[model samples]
Target: MAALSISLSAQNVTGLQGEAKNNLLRLTWVDSVDARGPVYIYRSVSPFEPGTDLSILGRLIKVPYGVQSYIDEVEFPGTWYYFVAASDTEGQRFELPLPPDNSIGIEILESSDRLAVSPAAPPAEIAHGGEPGVNSLSAAVEGDSVIVTFRAEDRGRAVVLYRSARPLKQARDLVGAVIVQPDIASPFIDYPVPGIPYYYAVIFEDDLTRGTAALYPGRNATVEAVEVPQGSDGVGLSSSASIRSLPLPMISLAAAVPGMNAFDETPSPVELSPEASKALEDLEPVQRKSSLAKSPRAFSQDLEAPGGGEEYALYSIMQDFFLKKDWDGCRNALAGYLGLPRSSASEARARFYLGQCYYFLGQPRESLFEFLSAQPAYPDESAEWIQASLAALVK
Candidate 1:
């Protein structure tokens, strides 16, 4: 009888190398000699040990035979280790370099570094069958919230996920949040614990495939509670209820001037000297009103005084803007006033005007947000405005 001889075929992936462009890593390699099996890619932050189970190494991608490259959009800036393995048609798996070789490595630097070395590259376009492509992602700390903005190619849906730490391994590791849709621009407000950092990522999914991108890394960003400036009046209103119950009278053109209905007639823009303009510019509208309270010449006596002397002046200005139907001017002044530290009553009034301004501007969402923010300052007074905003939103 002739001796039977059998030989095992070699299935090895070779020539692995990576290049870092911005936060994205592009990996390339030569296909295995036995091109009959699928290739699996694995990644880790630390070096892989000998005999490490390819199954447990956090599989990043699986490609059919003949595909030689993959692009990974890394979430955090650091070094990453990667390796590839191939499985034969018979289901026999073999690591690329067998037992003694080290995994390929790539170092992702900070965004600033990438910006310095090259013109900052636009985010890599992730293809998701007819889904809108996100062009950019940015976050800014505003008062106590993180405002995240996403600019996309077309209007579509996206799911946001966030974590407090680095190296986001998988989608399951993140806490899912808002589902954003197409708008002029998509903005999501994340109310995180003050002083804690956060990292955000968004996933755009379609029927065929899903694309993921990092929104914010929270490296130098953090939420900080803003301190409201003290008002001229010593007393401050605590809650929205207190503001609504206050005896402050609403200013209307009918009450501001005798025999002259503001709505019936337009008021000329008030002329100001360069000195007065400069002075007013330096102070918030609320603070400016406080300054005016010291001078009786700033306002007419016919306007009823509400709350403190300062509020009387503010109401006078607000009434003038409203009577003239100058929505833009009214909105700007109201924004300045609301940004200052104020009694709840003052905040409530500012929010009301701001909400109305937004409504007139055809921005129902902003109108609703202002009305809701005012709720904590004056629940009763804001209820009507809130209802109006909600109605506009429904329309």
Candidate 2:
């Protein structure tokens, strides 16, 4: 008799199992199969919709040719379902059905989900002198500057103090103080060295009565500590402390009157460093023309006005990054540019470029959001691009 021949089809994955611990779901499967192709894993919060393509279930992973395990760290509390499919070298895929070993689902219960709802806290009592004072004071290090911002409950004169070291329990620890009128929208920008960190405190005085209160990192002062010095008229005062050995630099408060105690006078303009000045320039809102220019001559006439230095720098950096196809660098630069307050046209342009960068980085969701934000600012220019991107993503 002639020799008999037999062949076997690619086997479906077997012995699949899963266990849930806290917010982690661990899955494992037997590797005894002789299949030689990639194994794809899919997950969903609910069972796949009827007639749903397996590719659209949101691929959780693609295990190597021989690997047979996966772990998912869920970010929220919920029940989740999972499935696995094995593909042969010839592009044939065999999906494994739910295992009899209870390995198809995982339930995560976060601590927050288990807690009972508590009653809301009572409203805070108003401060004396009709002064609501300042609250939600925050400080952050951005680049080489420390930006401080706070919400004022009442109109008042505010001062921000900076120190190199922490434990700023007393006013004497404050090395430099600057006056900031609460009427303005500008934030206090303290320029420090590149690598050093600093602490900050704020004091607000009522414009009518000089009742003073201080605000620290996490808490507000219940009692006023600043008192008007005897035998001196009510004038704005500058306070300072010394730090000889630290690498920090001292900011001058020469315009502040000494031994004065009053919030009557207008605060002196804050002198900004070169970098801060550039940043502020970049943030200045641009005024748009009431009507579009009709001809090339009109456009040329409009261009006669001088442009800001920082704005030019920002544009140059963006162009360079885009031309070089450096997606990450372009994204970061665009983000920094957007952080500064910008005009409507500038904001729209920056957002559009940022959306392009996100798309090139393989993040379609973020790109879609950015495109939507840019659409409102420049509808005529952004409508076509936004529609095309949305259509492609939907398909």
Candidate 3:
């Protein structure tokens, strides 16, 4: 009899799980020899030992020759044995990698599929969706009940409530007990024991594919809980809910005034003094420009082209160095600045900072490398300033 060559293959399954469910089994293979017909598939009732007779529960017949796939949905969740063999026109048989003599059945490890969560579940009666809108919870002066109002304009995942004693401290979860979405008015009422100052935040969980997401999108409000006054009869009117603005402050005109400012009245810019300006100018140009000036967001905006449309990549790196106070980060950002496309003048300024970063790192030789790179790139007047610095370094 002539020999028939054979091979077998397998692969890990992916995208087979969602929410809390799993679906479909996927496999891959390579390097097979003269495969013909649909690869036959079978499930064994029990684990088959090597060289043991096993029951053939089913077969995936007529598998096209050289085909590397066989998806069997007939099998249920349990261990099952599988074997593939090729039969020639003359009835000659060749088994791929020969099954472990009657080995344990192929493990059909299955998991349940997660039921579809209605992006609209909690009912229109309590439905909340899109991003969380205004979140306001205030206690009525006459009664013990507190009012909680919010708008869920966009459909999202679950909405949760957290309460903190201190502003922005770690919060304790207070989500379901108060109220859920699909509610009538924007604010609902919750009765709490009196005499504790409470800070509340409503978190709208994003429809997250990955782990990264902003837990809470809108502004958080704080209110202290107080005992209902002894004799008041009428229910206190709740304050009108306002749209919560972005948590991070921006330099746009809308952010300047409170009621007048388009965003909300926060504050105005404090003018820098002449002396402060000159002190800032003493640093390299990039340093002077990169330092925190007004709001962090505004400062970040100024790093790129005027009016801050696209962010300069180098500025982002530099900001990390400034915030982290990491010398190594400064060095990395300095190198990145050098690699940026810029006019020769800008290059000279960037090189000067490269030297400064090295000096900060206590590497005078490496600092000299950057200073040398800057000398020819800068004008004589600028180069002279660097020359004077060399004398200071020696001294």
Q: What clash count goes with each model?
A: 2, 0, 29
Model 2, residue 379: displacement in angstroms?
48
Off by over 4 Å in 3: 1-23, 34-38, 48-50, 54-60, 95-395
TM-score of candidate 1 against the unseen true structure: 0.30
Summarize candidate 1's per-residue lDDT along 1-395 as a digit string, tens digits: 12221112246676666777787777777766764688777876444545666564445577777888888886665456677777788766666333212246565655444511111111232111223255345566665455776655546553333334343333333322222321233577555544444554444433101212232222211121222233211124334323222357766765565666567754445579999989989986563332111111112332465776658657766677855667788788777766768777666666666777887787766766666666665566666655555445444
- TM-score for each of the candidates: 0.30, 0.25, 0.20
Ranking the candidates on TM-score from highest down gives 1, 2, 3
Query: Runs in model 1 with CA error above 4 Å?
Result: 1-9, 96-102, 112-395
Best by lDDT: 1
Residues 1-395 of candidate 3 have per-residue lDDT tens digits of: 12222122221111111121232333223312443333443333332233434333343444544554555442233223344445444544444323232111233333435322211111122232322243433334335545655555543445544444443211112211232232234455544434544455554432111112122212333333335342322234233422221235557655444445465555556679999999998976563354322211113332554433123554555466744557688778767666757767556656665666665566654554455566565444234433433333434
Candidate achieving higher TM-score, 2 or 3: 2
Overlapping backbone residue pairs in candidate 3 total: 29
lDDT of 2 by residue, 83-142 (tens): 666667776765644333212555454444332211111124211222325555556654
Error of 2 at 52 (Å): 4.6
1 or 2, greater by TM-score: 1
Model 2: runs farther than 4 Å from truth?
Answer: 1-10, 32-34, 48-52, 99-103, 112-395
Query: Can you give the lDDT of residue 84 in candidate 1?
Result: 71
